[model samples]
Target: MEDDMLTCNSVESPGPPFLDNAASSVATSLRRCANDKLPVSDNRDTTVSRWRKHCPTPIENDNIFEIETHCKDPELCSTLACDIYKHLREAEAKKRPSPDFLETTQKDIDTSMRAVLIDWLVEVSISRKKVTEEYRLVPETLYLTVSYIDRYLSSKEINRDKLQLLGIACLLIAAKYEEICPPQVEELCYITDNTYIKDEVLRMEASILGCLMFEMTAPTEKCFLRRFLHAAQLCHEGPALHLEFLASYITELSLLEYSLLCHVPSLIAASSIFLANFILKPTKNPWNTTLSYHTQYKPSTLRDCVKVLHRLFRVGLGSNLPAIREKYSQHKYKFVAKKYCRPSIPADFFQDASS
Candidate 1:
């Protein structure tokens, strides 16, 4: 029973020629929406824009308290509830991928290629033709895999052909770090249709680890979602299982989006919960004192991220990338992807706590 992260063993090997030590910095070649802010604002780059925006605003009026209930459950590591997140909030700033990788460190690929690569990874991770139940990577693995790729790109440039190679290798790394029984290197090569031999995958893995100094335990939206979802359960409603799936679905969709880099992982997770709540229970408010207390985010701060995710929800699988949609549409996930939020939410939704 490891904490989804305490995993992974690396090898000492040279990477393929593709992870060329070249430099190319390009921004969005394909913008999904006009409001899509791809560049990470200097002020908003780190989770520590002092998390100034994430700090809770003065809500109507009630003393907010620590989430003591979760701490009571030993299985949840009640002891670390507050400290872990405090560490995560601080760590996120130091470990975040270069907010300007495309504009500085990376040059070969643009946002389009990155999007395609992410979409393909999502598809292949769950595609019947590419993987099986035993090999199926968990959501945490997928998220970390993307994190590795982005961080790698932030430091080193890669050609288009090698982009897919980088993706598979990162997937293998993340799988090992987050999976109980990670898929074998050979199986990963097979998933690539043997495009990369086992040795090539290993070489890339070693390079990625070296680049990041073997730190794959950084916080991600998935990590924050686990804790935030628990906070979400505090609703008067009894265990709304559908809310879990829906919020998870929304969070996964952000994986394909390069523009969301501006937002912190915690904010992204919070936005997912906000949108999920709205979808499942629209007549009622989405954000509440409980969520605000735990997330340290007032509804005003969530407006931008929430609107972006809400746009994604409204668009509903319009892009060629259908793996996320297909994955969530299945019965196992309660068909949360099939459920849609309206094109717009009430303006007052943002007014309750922060205005």
Candidate 2:
């Protein structure tokens, strides 16, 4: 299969290189960091400060070892790990695999691990929400944000304290990637409630893009379902409304714990559509028709995807998605008529939790 994507030029530099030392010693030091629960800030800051002081100016594409040391600092261990990361990244660049590989397939993640993932997403979303700016485009804006954290965690032992900063950087990157009008560096500082420095956000952004190898073709719920809905000829207004509702709800839930690596844009979008259809049109029998068409192309089963999505709604949404009805009352939403709240809903519509 010809991967047209790889042929495109995406110069994601893997920073600098590390030295060649004993792997066991490096592993031992990292183990201590994890066992002691050394604040991620301590390690991360140390590595970053080191990079700023010792790292090359105008970083070269092959200088990955220097960057790897910033990930770990034990004098000898840092050298060893940097060397390895540099070599691996070189191999990867030659082959050019997609960066969204972490969440590419559920089979790669044990069935039992899905719940843990949901919990992680929920925690990230709630924390980010407390500090994120209002009018931040779509809910899946947090999807890629969470993905950066998960991808880093899979290989490194980062303390939870730095998670928010990482989240901020990821969001900043996603905003630029997904939104027409991206937020400014100062605006992002405000969004993170001034938790991180502007320079830190900039550095983190470069690191994340590097970590993902500048590959960011992950699918969002709407992106996934739009193609499927069109091919299935389910593009009427009624279906559109339902899909919007479901996509919003599901995508929000996804922000809570779902990793962008776990599903393709199409899979995420299609799965949400299936769940929404199941919830709204229960009378429609044989839901298989909704998914049967995409089975050939996707690596996952439709039933499995739907099951995962429904589980996400139940846990991630926290009992029916902070119902706008119970909180604001139908009168505020114009008795659920979508009239006053349709084209021009009040600012508070989203400002409030129900929104």
Clashes of each: 3, 22
Residue range with the least summed lDDT across 10 consecutive positions in model 1? 23-32
For candidate 2, write residues 1-355 as lDDT tens digits: 2465434423342422243357657877899989789645546557555545532233223312333333333653543432333343344333322344334422244322433444443443333343444553544555555555555545444344565666667777877877787667776676556888899889878887887788664534444444445433332235455445554455445544443345444555556655555554544421332233332222233445556656655444454334322222234222321212112212221121112
Q: Each prediction's TM-score against the native?
A: 0.78, 0.48
Which regions of candidate 1 fall more than 4 Å away from where they truly are? Answer: 1-66, 70-72, 127-133, 236-239, 352-354
Candidate 1, residues 289-343, lDDT tens digits: the string is 8888888788888999898898877784456777788888999999888885787
lDDT of each: 0.79, 0.47
